[model samples]
Target: MKIILSNASSDPIYIQIVNQIRQSILSGELRAGDSLPSIRQLAKDLQVSVITTKRAYEELEKEKLIDSVVGKGCFVSGANKDFIREQRMTRLEEKMVEIIRESKELSMSKQDVLDYLNLLYEEEHTP
Candidate 1:
């Protein structure tokens, strides 16, 4: 597992860790039953505090994205497709709300935002 810490980022370290791990799981990089490093081990590896790593893991567990077994490490949960899709849609909506708020603050028109988003989609989707 690889995690890069950004001191200049607005997001907290725990949140960054949580987001990256969730992305990894969604991308199949960390599949179901894959054992994650122990809290202490991950903390040491990331050079972050144990509490931060613990909080990240706790959030993942709370989201039902991972499971912890007694005497065993945390493993990615085998979630149903519909559950995963719903979770992803909820997250996307939250992010979209933030973007919309930022656009309003910047006085950007709806058409301008839509155009930019379409450009971004094309750039990402194109070969």
Candidate 2:
């Protein structure tokens, strides 16, 4: 699994890690049963506090998105694909609503928002 940190972002570090990992699982980049990096190793690699990574992992476990085995490590849960997809879409819609509200606060017109979104889509899909 791959994770990137954004010190400049308003979101907490642990939340960023959790959301990215969750996205990976939903996108099929991290398959069910795939083992995750140990907390200490991920902390070292991400240069974050062990507590932060641990909290993120614990939250994921609580959500049943991942399972921790004693002596073995944390692995992605064998969750149903349809369920995961629905959950992912719901989260995406919530975030999109937040973005739309922010755009409205900035007084962006509908056309402007659409153009900006198209630009974002192109950027994300760019090779």
Candidate 3:
């Protein structure tokens, strides 16, 4: 597992850690039953306080993305496709709402926004 910290980010260190680990799991970079570094080891590797890593782990556990076993450390939880899809859709909806609000404020027509979105999607999908 790899995590990079940015002092310039407004988000707290623990949140950054949590987000990166969550992304790794979602992207299949980390698989189910994969053992994560111990809290102390991760803290040392990241040069952060152990409390920060512990907090990130706790948050992951609460989200059901990871499971902690006594004396065995934490491991990635089994994937729940439906739950992951729902979570992703919810996040997309929130971002779409923000985009809609911004487009309205800029006086952009619905077709104009759709055209821009299609261009972006095609650009990303194209080689």
**Candidate 3 per-residue lDDT over residues 1-127, each given as its tens digit:** 7899999999999999999999999888999999999999999999999999999999999888999999999999996957976877897999999999999999999999999999999999999
Off by over 4 Å in 3: 95-127
lDDT of 2 at 126: 100
**Model 1 lDDT, residue 69, Cα:** 91
Task: Encode model 1's per-residue lDDT on 30-124: one tens digit a residue.
Answer: 98989999999999999999999999999999889999897898999998757976988998999999999999999999999999999999999
Summing lDDT over every window of 10 consecutive residues in candidate 2, give the lowest-scoring window.
79-88
RMSD of each: 2.8, 2.9, 3.1
| Candidates arranged by lDDT, highest first | 3, 1, 2
Give candidate 1's root-mean-square deviation (CA, Å): 2.8
**Model 2: C-alpha RMSD to truth?**
2.9
Ranking by TM-score: 1, 3, 2
Assess the local accuracy of residue 84 in candidate 3 as a C-alpha lDDT between 0 and 100. Answer: 70
Give per-model TM-scores. Answer: 0.80, 0.72, 0.73
Best by lDDT: 3
- What does candidate 2's lDDT look like per residue over 10-108, in tens digits? 999998998999889888899989999999999999998999999999988876789999899999999887877787689789999998999999999
